[model samples]
Target: MKKPFRKKRQGGFTLLQFALVVLVSSIVSAVALNRFEYYREQAEIAAARQVVASLRTSLQARAAQLLSTGRERELQQLASANPMNLLLWKPENYLGEYYAPDPQQIGGAGWVFDPRDRSLVYLPRNARSFSFGSSKLLRFKVEFVRISNKSLALNQVSG
Candidate 1:
């Protein structure tokens, strides 16, 4: 008795070809993901800026309303007061009524106002990961544009 030999059939992808394709695609994927993460962070930063702008507008509007009337003493107090510490407890004040700053409203950034310089500050919760002097440096710089009684100017961040 005699047996006959048969040839093997070829497949779609060989081991080395598959490995090369996977390696190339993985490197490309890594680069794309890195870019995507950067864009996402930028978006978060932009959202934070917008939130600060809204808050500044409200504060300026209130300040204008207060200054327009003959309530200099009360307006002075409100300007010097911290919106969060007092407004959270009491929304109504001599300047006018306003809501408190809620972190949840601004994606968890703790909102604080510096009456000395009149700058609205917003720092991401993950502040430590930003810069070397993250404690002293503000990742986002907010400007009230104008706090006069004519019209409220939205806050703009200095880049």
Candidate 2:
């Protein structure tokens, strides 16, 4: 009668069960970390693309204003501006530093705005030199192009 009344009591979980729990949690965490990294890269790339889009839209708007508002002469001048001077400097170089950064700006990642192609080219300053133009590679290690806008200062401009 006493043996029948006694209940078999089990001690907590086995070692194998604990180990499996830990393994499952670690695998879940690893997968989550990988997902976070992928999304982070995508966000950074999108930010760079927005930079290109803003530049393109601004150039087109300025050109259209100049062409339609009795400022055709100025628009024509910009259209004929030298490519080296335009991308290298700007339509009005003396107005301000518009083509690239002050060269002393933070990161020194000097950029060139190609109004013709609606591209914001990132021309990084080399470690060997402080000048952004020091490397005549004529290629950007990273560049983004905007496809929606037309070239600025065109012969005919429309909204």
Candidate 3:
């Protein structure tokens, strides 16, 4: 007698196929994570640049006001003062004035004015890829600079 025909078996992925899929998935995940971290660092740097630009503009405006009021001598004082004070609104990342800020205490990407050093410091959250030379913190100081024979300007000097 002839035997009856049967359909072929259909099942889920085999062990080898499953392992390959997992390996590819993990590789993609790792690459995506690294890219995300890189973008985050770039964003932090851009935000810092924007804040610095705003600060320079505010410093110039304050200096101009003082000059108009005939207080040019007082312009020198701006060099040591907290530049954040000149802004109408302080950035949310600003941690206010600190005499000697401890990096461990500040803990993340933000701004702090060190009264002792008379410098504005920026702490990066993603500092691993950034090259800050000997120090990880970026510091800036405001100073009056003579640009021309009859012109004076308030400028931000990186420290």
Cα RMSD for predicted model 1: 8.3
Error of 2 at 139 (Å): 8.7
Model number with the top TM-score? 3
In TM-score terms, candidate 2 sits at 0.46
lDDT of 1: 0.51
Q: Best candidate, lDDT-wise?
A: 3
- Candidate 1 residue-wise lDDT, 1-159, digit = tens: 677787889769989999999999999999999998778767656665555555565666576677678665565555445544332232221122114333355454444554445544554555544432424224222223443433334333341
C-alpha lDDT values of all predictions: 0.51, 0.45, 0.78
| Total clashing pairs for each candidate | 0, 0, 0
RMSD in Å for model 2: 11.0
- Assess candidate 3 and give its lDDT: 0.78
Stronger candidate by TM-score (2 vs 3): 3
Task: Give per-residue CA lDDT, model 3, range 1-159, as digits (tens).
Answer: 898998989999999999999999999999999999889888888888899898888887877888888887777787678888988899889987777777688775689998997888887775566635666678888755765522234344454
User: Where does candidate 3 have its weakest 10-residue lDDT segment?
Assistant: 149-158
Q: Under the 3 Å rule for N, CA and C atoms, how many clashes does model 1 have? A: 0
Q: In candidate 2, how many Å is residue 145 off? A: 14
What tens-digit string does per-residue lDDT give for candidate 2 at 23-102? 99999999999998767655544544444454445556656677577675665455444323333323221222244333
